[model samples]
Target: MKNLFLCSSFFDVAGILPNFLERINSNCIQTVSFIDIASHVEEYKEYVEKAKLAFEQQSLKLEVIDFNQSSDDIVQQLQKNDLIYISGGNTFYLLQMLNEKKLTNVIVDLINYGKPYIGESAGSVLLSENIEYIKKMDNPQNAPNLKNYKSLNIIDFYPVPHFENQPFKNLVEQVISEYGESLPLIAFDNKQALWVLDKTIILKDET
Candidate 1:
């Protein structure tokens, strides 16, 4: 019952998701909690707008829960949502917040219970065993004192998001040289998605 649709860019990929809707129980994703950590550096209006449009286009009712409040408050709110979507952003900061809030275990519990979860960009990177891949794409100084750098370990391969784009693309070689030897790395852009259902893994992208 493990279902995941780790996407690169929700709006950027556009019509691609409708194809995978059937796998998500056809429940219309009624309530949602969007972890908006990635867009922390910018206004959230755009991300929310795009997400709203995407849900509407799919004929799904989405009630986005605000997660910027206290960890206790967030956790309480989380119980109301049927879906959890982590948006792309500063991975280090995102993980830092999750740990600092002590909300990591709750998320682990939720996902382990077979709740559908979606991750994009930095969100996708956190699904690996470790966030060492963030060394190349994001700055750890935001959470430099972070002691536990371990990721969710839900997936085995490291998803090097933003394969051919700026900033992130520049560090691909370095990330590969450092971790690619032991850890498997799969590079993807805004147009791709990694679909996971228990033991089966599929890459949804343009061939």
Candidate 2:
């Protein structure tokens, strides 16, 4: 069964994370594989620090993994962790690194095997079958080496993170207005999340 918690912003929904973990009977999670390769800029680095603190508050030891610098074994690193967290950043860059490192299949297999996976923003979008839908919201120029917009394909519906939220509000609306009829978009705000448990899916609101 696939256990996925897709969120617009991890900090926005961090308080309710424990409840979700409880619902999935994963309260015992101790170690997490924090994938923050998407956050390459100085500004995003600050957000990553807060994300690390969030995990620390839950008493979850995090093994931060950066595909850009680390030469470690991806499969072994992920397999050793109790949970997998993909932070928010440039969607194109994130996909480019994952594709370059060939970690997409590894992550998909682990999640399918029941490993709890948490995705924030870009992370959430990467689970969709194709990431081309988010081109308007995220700059594709960040990933010049990307061969295609294909993604993990773990979920059938396209996730529109930060829906109706600032900065991305207009962009999100544009994406919906253009792809609403052509794509299966599951749009949600920062305080909401898309929970996927096996074949059952639910849109959870923290408001």
Candidate 3:
């Protein structure tokens, strides 16, 4: 069964993550393979630390992987982890690195094989059928090597993260305005997340 926890801002919802995992009977997670390739830039780098702190608070070990660096053992690293996390950053750049490293299929296969997956912000957006609609919120120029906007296509609907939240509020609105009629866009705020189990998708909030 496919399991996914897609979030707008993981830091905002970290406190309740364990509860959700417990509900899904996945609270035994001891280690996580954190894909930090998205937040590769200097400014976005801070998010990686925050993510590590979140996992540390849960007493879970983390093995962070950055595709920009030597990731020859990416498959082995991912297979050893109990959970997989993709951090938020430049969506285009993140996708570019995933494609460049040719780990997209590997990730998809792992998720399909029941490895729990968590995506925050750009990470959440990357699961959609196509990331072309996100150009309004994230700069496409950041991914100079990206040949296409095609994405993991893990989920059929488009996940609009940071909805009604600062900085990205207007950008998210723009995307919804442009693609709302055509694409199946699910917009959620920093306090909300999409819990996907196989074909069933549920939107949950802190409340």
Each model's TM-score, in the order given?
Answer: 0.86, 0.95, 0.95
Q: Tens digit of lDDT per residue, candidate 2, span 1-207? A: 999999988877788888889989998899999999898842556667888998999888999885655435876889999999999999899999888888899999999999999999999999999999998898999999999998999998999999989988999999999999999999999899889998888888885
| Ranking 1 against 3 by TM-score, winner | 3
Give the poorly placed runs of model 3, Cα more than 4 Å off. 68-71
**Worst 10-residue lDDT window, candidate 3:** 64-73
lDDT of 3 by residue, 93-132 (tens): 9999988888889889999988899999999999998999
> Candidates ranked by lDDT, best first?
2, 3, 1
The most accurate candidate by lDDT is 2
- Going through the candidates in the order shown, the clash numbers are 1, 0, 0
lDDT of 1 by residue, 22-46 (tens): 6666456666677776567544337
Pairs that collide in candidate 3 are: none
Cα lDDT computed for each candidate against the true fold:
0.74, 0.89, 0.88
Clashing pairs in 1: 38-89
